[model samples]
Target: MRTVPVAEAKAHFSELLKAVEAGEEIVITRRGRAVARLCSQRPLTAAEVLAPLWHEPLDIEAPEDRAPEPVAEWDD
Candidate 1:
């Protein structure tokens, strides 16, 4: 973790982002008081990304009840 004044933080914003990307936490202070923090976000896994989609039911219409059409087999 690192602490920097607001003015310095603004001046070296890009460098601070680089540090944050490298998993460093930064605290920004204004007039000697802590104001903001910078940190990298953890990447979501495949299951975590799909969790929301699983929560809601999809609004898809069911196919009509009838005999299914046969798919033609293709010859190589």
Candidate 2:
């Protein structure tokens, strides 16, 4: 982890991003107070994105169990 002033961060944005990509965390400070953090974000797989809902019960009904919708008649 590292702390950098906002102005310094802006001056070396590309370098900071490269460091973050290499798994380093950076904290940006404004007037000596921490304002933001920069960290690498990896793409999530479909399975990973749906993992939280995997164990939850779904209330969806099968197509065969659904009521049939009425057909409308058209006049020529």
Candidate 3:
């Protein structure tokens, strides 16, 4: 990830577009606070979004069951 000040990004808009096309993410900031990002595209699914940094084991243990809590009714 890379950061570019808002003014710099505005002045070098073409360069920023090229960087984004080359798969380099850029964050635009205003007053030292991040305001936007330049990236390829959005993930299609929740799994896609989480897949890059998460892993699942093929075999896993099941948790023990606990007693169910009683349901309560609410009245207005």
Candidate 4:
């Protein structure tokens, strides 16, 4: 965790966000008093961001079986 004056926070806002993304917590202070806290809004791994965790199995009914018939040549 880190404490920074409001002015500094404002000046380095981008850097602050980058730090937060890197897992660093930040405290914004005003007049030496804690006013706000900053942390990663959403932390996710690459796999999580890429796809859903659960996928429903596909449902396909099998075709009905039929009795085999002799070939037409058998009649000849």
**Model 1: per-residue lDDT, tens digit, 1-76?**
7999999999999999999887677999999999999987976467655665686765789988998889999999
Candidate 2 positional error at 24, Å: 0.2
Worst 10 residues of 2 by lDDT: 43-52
- Candidate 3 stretches with Cα past 4 Å from truth are 42-76
Q: Looking at model 3, which ten-residue stretch has the lowest summed lDDT?
A: 42-51
Candidate with maximal lDDT = 1
Alpha-carbon runs more than 4 Å astray in model 2: 43-76
Residue 60 Cα positional deviation in candidate 4, in Å, after optimal superposition? 48
Q: Write model 3 residue lDDT over 26-75, tens digit each, in one string.
A: 99999999999988674346654455666664466899999999999989
Per-candidate clashes, comma-separated: 0, 0, 0, 0
User: Relative to the true structure, how large is the alpha-carbon lDDT of every model?
Assistant: 0.86, 0.86, 0.82, 0.85
TM-score of each: 0.55, 0.55, 0.54, 0.54
Could you tell me which residue pairs clash in candidate 2?
none
What's the CA RMSD of model 1 in angstroms?
11.1
